[model samples]
Target chain A: MSTPLLSQGTPPVVRKKISDPLPVRILLIGLTLLFFIGFVFLPLGLVFAQAFQKGWDFYLEAIREPYTIEAVKLTLTTVAIVVPLNAFFGVTAAWAITKFSFPGKAALKTLLDLPFAVSPVIAGLIFVLLLGSRTPFGSWLGEQGIKIIFSTPGIIIATLFVTFPFVARELIPLMEAQGRDEEEAALTLGAKGWQIFGKITLPNIRWGLLYGMILCSARAIGEFGAVSVVSGHIRGQTNTIPLHVEILYSEYNFTASFAVASLLVFLALTTVIVKAVMENRFQKNSSQH
Target chain B: MGIELQNITKKFTDYTALDNISLNIASGELIALLGPSGCGKTTLLRIIAGLESADSGKIILEGKDTTNLPPREKNVGFVFQHYALFRRLNVYENVAFGLKVLPRSKRPSKSEIKDRVEHLLKLVQMEWALKRYPSQLSGGQRQRVALARALAVNPRVLLLDEPFSALDAKVRQELRRWLRKLHDEIHVTSIFVTHDQEEALELADRIVVINKGKIEQQGTPQEVYDHPANAFVYNFLGNVNVFHGRVHEGMVTLGGHSVDAPDELKNSAEKTSQTFVRPHEIGISKIRSEGNDLEGTIREIRLLGGQIGLNIECEGFDQPIDAEIPRELYLNLQLKKGDRVFVTFNKVKVFACDYEI
Candidate 1:
């Protein structure tokens, strides 16, 4: 089925559809777009309306307060740390998983994607098992003055666990399809391994990497379940923006909660915009190919 | 530089791709390792270039054994059939990649690298395409850029594996001639692997014929064409017409007709043999009670661009004899399917069929 445009001489471009019957295809697309608007855009509009009910005074006062400012700082800092480190880990893991032939390769790939399949709560528990003060390694590290649990590190670890596969998963199939031919060509041309990665492999995969990083940062910043389990939600000490929103909600401060949540909603929207831009760049590269 | 291989072999589990092959190539020579698919010609080229490690062999380049050396250590330029140009790099960057990667002390200066790359690009007549990415160039142009990039390294030897097999027929023919001219001008010891006999005959200084993971013959193109060492070489090199015959009473009996045998075979013992002659060498004419003639009926006729092929069925020969005649000569004959004709076998070479024919 296709959407046919009326024509005078030459027929207009007809958009193709996987289904039969033009009316049914149009109905299906209309329903999907309606669903997006109702479910996604409606709730977002509701949150924005709530944030501005008392005018810009409430929004500005909520954002300028020291605790709210600190929480925002902590969230941004966590994302900054998580994005680059995960990007590196992703590139390395993807390169190893795709290029080198070895035993246990399939098992390694499945393990790398474990966090994506497992619950965020269980991911948080994994860090607790390894780093909580109750365990021997944890207590020993605590004696050396390392405080992981109920601190910023704990939140970062939980975010890292849940967001581990984003960049690497994005890069593996891209690198695999691109093949090692260009890398081999560069190597033969006297480029070292790092030089090849920089000049050929990196540029080829930069768009996918950026998209993955944006998604990772979005999930890292907006994370609640995993970070909640690890952070202990101490006010003004280890509270992230999401935890701050939860704190305000528990105290029945609906306006403050919605205000902070709206801020994060804006951050997430920026992440989405970054993703859209990266995807557009990737599409241009693919069309050129 | 000269290349010599001794007892070179490569095996993959149950299949042996190359077996105990040895050859000596002179300096500044363009040798074509000509063979059918899976004949191990590319494997031999890779072994010599150090891209592949031979299971058992000694690769002596410039009088020094380099069998264990890696490709980078050997300083050999290799052009893959796919070209393998860096898609992200413009033509200039791709050409300068090798020089820029050398150690700081050994690396060429910026201007030197630029000049060398420019010079090589001009050599391949690709200077105008320098600012363009590989994706913007056509397949033939990309191959030319690949060749220029390879030459910029000033390799000790150049190895190309079916370099022109990816192009159209016309482009392939043009590139074949261009590569030959490039080789002559540069005077680099180069070895190329190809399955095209015409390219091998026209471009290579020496053609090494390989079949079934073994060398069938290695010689000048004329030597292999006019004096093939065996039946396989004769049939592989060109279209040959074969006839079963026996030496009896000091006379060669073919199709129940007698002809004088070559002098050396006159006094020899009677032996059964397979006599093979190229289609272009044998003469075909209409049967008019001609002297030393074998009667046959033309079964099929094919008109090629410059030549014509006739398939003739004769008694005592189950398979039809194929004759390739020039178009100019074809005009003088009224040969067609179902027409009776006499095929005159000229001085044909005979090989004994004692063990296997």
Candidate 2:
């Protein structure tokens, strides 16, 4: 047998990346980093800097204000209530869309996404028009001793409208990707509807649900335009955190406004971090589970 | 008693997936629904398992009408093609899912459930990977766990939908053998769907061939293979050489050659008929023998492992006839392409021209 000596015959070859050339890759990466720095980091850093500009005492005083605490409580309450409601709605909607084939399914999916495309202000207007005191349904509800407008319910409703699609939209594609075969298997194994859902469906969609919940919470907490529309700006009564922050800024209390804004920034940052951690777990769970 | 599907018809919009399909499965018999893709074999199995609703029919299990019953009430173990093990659950948990899902009044105790799951896992020979999640396991392992999961319920009948079709070829063969052995030990009436003729022929005690929402034939594997009911069954069961010819003078003529027709075809109204013969049934000779049926020249010789395949081109035949010869015979003959040979068909199935494959 003759030895080929292939290594000696061939010259060293330089591997070239066709997907992205060196200059283009570097330029694209640099531009992305610069965009995040200038828009995200700068704004976030400025909020904290300006909040503490008046020193720790002023920042503490602003946070300790009774109205500030009220707004914080209201935002938390809205998130606590809205997140679960929307999550439930999202799960049922996603389940219906993925599990069954029915007429008008596509239309139902489209309608679920309507709130997403509508401006936050328009969402608030839609709710207000349907539920306000001047409307028949609103008056009927008022006759039943319910207050929807200029109240916590109204603010919560607006926030819910704005954040509703986050959970369902994220979950639908995930549920669809994870087909109904497992559920069918469970059912044929003598599993009831609830058992199949809890044992098979819920475990498969937990990470997606949690991711959607965090995002929904963040959106609900940070909702400004819609809440501002229906809140009526009642200082400690109807004002959510975002509306309260606007009130503080308009009153020239920049430090107080930024201090309130800094809370939202922390929440957004935490959401991103949680999403990053959850994303890795999500992929791992989906692949290995 | 086993299962009896009475006129089970299912339609998806205008497309009839199962057109009044009726079947009788014997107790403790392992059967297979064999057909090509979209041939309603899977639909038949799903209908029997209560995973799919039939438009109009009766599903009788153990002599009781189970029509319109939901899957939860069916008491049947269904293994899907994709395995469909709970992705989040470990192998042990997945196998135990059926036992756990049983009503609390009827559910086995925890220790009993554990013992059952372990026994089933061992039955499928997947006990070593009990703690591994489905995604962490290979396709073959997942299917084993899926089988164990289905058996966990101890249902009267077991239904599998192309249980090993998703696996690679080698794994699919191994699993088919494993499934046959498992069915033997359990003695549970089992029905599985498959498009592979070998899998159905090897694993099934009875083969039900479905086509276009109807049962084409149902009998022992050998029965369907040796004497296929129609052109579809003849072609779908295995490789067969189709000879399209005319019926004249009590014989079917191919090119310039002729063979005696079947008893029923005497003076048949049909002007044309197709004669089907298996590859191995055709005898090859270097010269024209006394009972030779056709004169042909070898177009191609293929080495098919222990058997040698020859594609013989004959006059007036659109496609070359495939003849399989034993390796020993092929070696002794030293046959090559373009060799003149006479073929003697030992057995032939004659069908109407309209039923040509």
Candidate 3:
């Protein structure tokens, strides 16, 4: 009788208080894994597998091609230029919006979000219509012998427009949550405006700023539609990595295209790893309290 | 250093945050600006600190007209309620921030800064956590670090905005005593804002009670607590039972009892008034008393450690009358709920209905 009572009591006690039935849990988990493999992991794995199909030598040769190297350089340059500018703009914008009250604030906030709402293709087209030789300003610019459309500067501008909102969007909520207390404390401590910004505000938002810059860099590097529209597909000139891959794939250079695409995939993987490390560090720091 | 404000006024949009207000602070006085939330006590403090500028005012600090000076130039130390210690910096760096940010000509040397920071940390009794970040410390420890950071500048005036309000009751009490002792030793002219009357009474050398952007009264703790200026001050300072009645011929009648009014209300015209009596000022007895006694049945009894509270309900009264008695007296009476008792007012203040609370 005691053994029977123990078995009846143990079964109910061992069941989890908040969980679905076993079969339903299994089904949900299986569906998630299936979607991940089919949509994400499979394509990432295939890029590398196809790139190295011939051998390491062939893959290295494809990557060392002149156009591929130029594409890599152009992508890096765009990222280097875009990330710092965006970071600066993002910090100032977030600071101004969160810390001060002024007229036109709501309008300014909505204008900042315009890039996120407008299509990248439309953004590229708008720049073209404003700067192309057909318009008066464009004609004046052309008369001055500064060709903007269908050039490298146009490519940079288009990429800049497409990736404009990444850093600011990441920072606004973080800064707003932080409030103005520390800055005010610093001010009352006889610290000047620049000192308060450098010693207090900047340090407080460093992690958010880094995260924003990383995101901006990633988008700037991978931006294709806007850059393509402005690039004019000038081989060894305005062709970024993504545009280069398109050109290579269209010319039936599958191995070369895969090799070039692998570089982007590698950068993305590195970003994810860095993000994971930062998140772990952040959580550990918070939990230490 | 002593500080003086001359007719300070501030308005936000159409709402007046602070009306024309004037105050004077003697050197080495720890004054508490006591008020409810949104009473503009904080606005006045901020104006003095130069964190906010009053629309029309002159701020005089140490006999200098510093109304137009910025916060950094004002040389005031402000401790925020949330203990706004720099989160990324450890305790040492946070304490040294003010010193390090000084102008090149006045900045301390490296060794001097370290010594000062260490001394401040020890002064706050948080030297053990010098290397810990703000997130690593408890709320009480964070506040101590914040105090050290604020004091590092050695400003003429120190302003605290509800400094200990974020801590728990036990910690708050401990910190209050510690802060009082610290102020006595350092002798900085400090002003703190608080809505807690008990805190103001316990901590401040002088209490300034503010209401609706105006100064209600300013006095020593005992003076304000013993004699509130008006109905608002009396009601705000402590819990009191209000008895609506009529005053005529130097006597105020409440329910079935009439007591002689205070001298100030004696010669006035007959008018309806509300008599305020503190719970402890009412006497409770099992038998009827000789002078102005109202008989009622005990509706409830509460044990409050040292004192026993009885709620008495009498005829012609809409609310239960609260009476607090000593434990010994309550034990001698042997009263329980539904027992008949007599309650008499020992002290009362009468105010006409026209005065708003």
**CAPRI docking class of candidate 2:** acceptable
Residue-level lDDT for B268 in candidate 1: 77
Model 3 CA lDDT for position B4: 90
Which sequence of candidate numbers ranks them by DockQ, best first? 2, 3, 1
Score residue B44 of candidate 3 by CA lDDT.
Answer: 92
- State which docking tier applies to candidate 3: acceptable
- lDDT per residue for candidate 2 within A1-289, as digits (tens), equals 1211111112348999569788999999999999999998998899999999999999889989999999999999999999999999999999999999999999999999888899999988888899999999999999999989889999988988899899999899999998888998888888889988888899889999999998999899899888888889998898888889999999998999999888878888998999999989988777664
Clash pairs of candidate 2?
Answer: A289-B87
Task: Provide the lDDT at A198 for model 2.
Answer: 87
DockQ of 3: 0.37
| lDDT per residue as tens, model 1, A174-220 | 98988876776665566777887888889888888998898899999
Where model 1 places Cα greater than 4 Å from the true spot, the runs are A1-21, A287-289, B238-282, B288-300, B311-321, B344-357
Candidate 1 has which clashing residue pairs, if any? A189-B98
TM-score of each: 0.87, 0.94, 0.94
* A287: Cα error in model 3, Å: 6.3
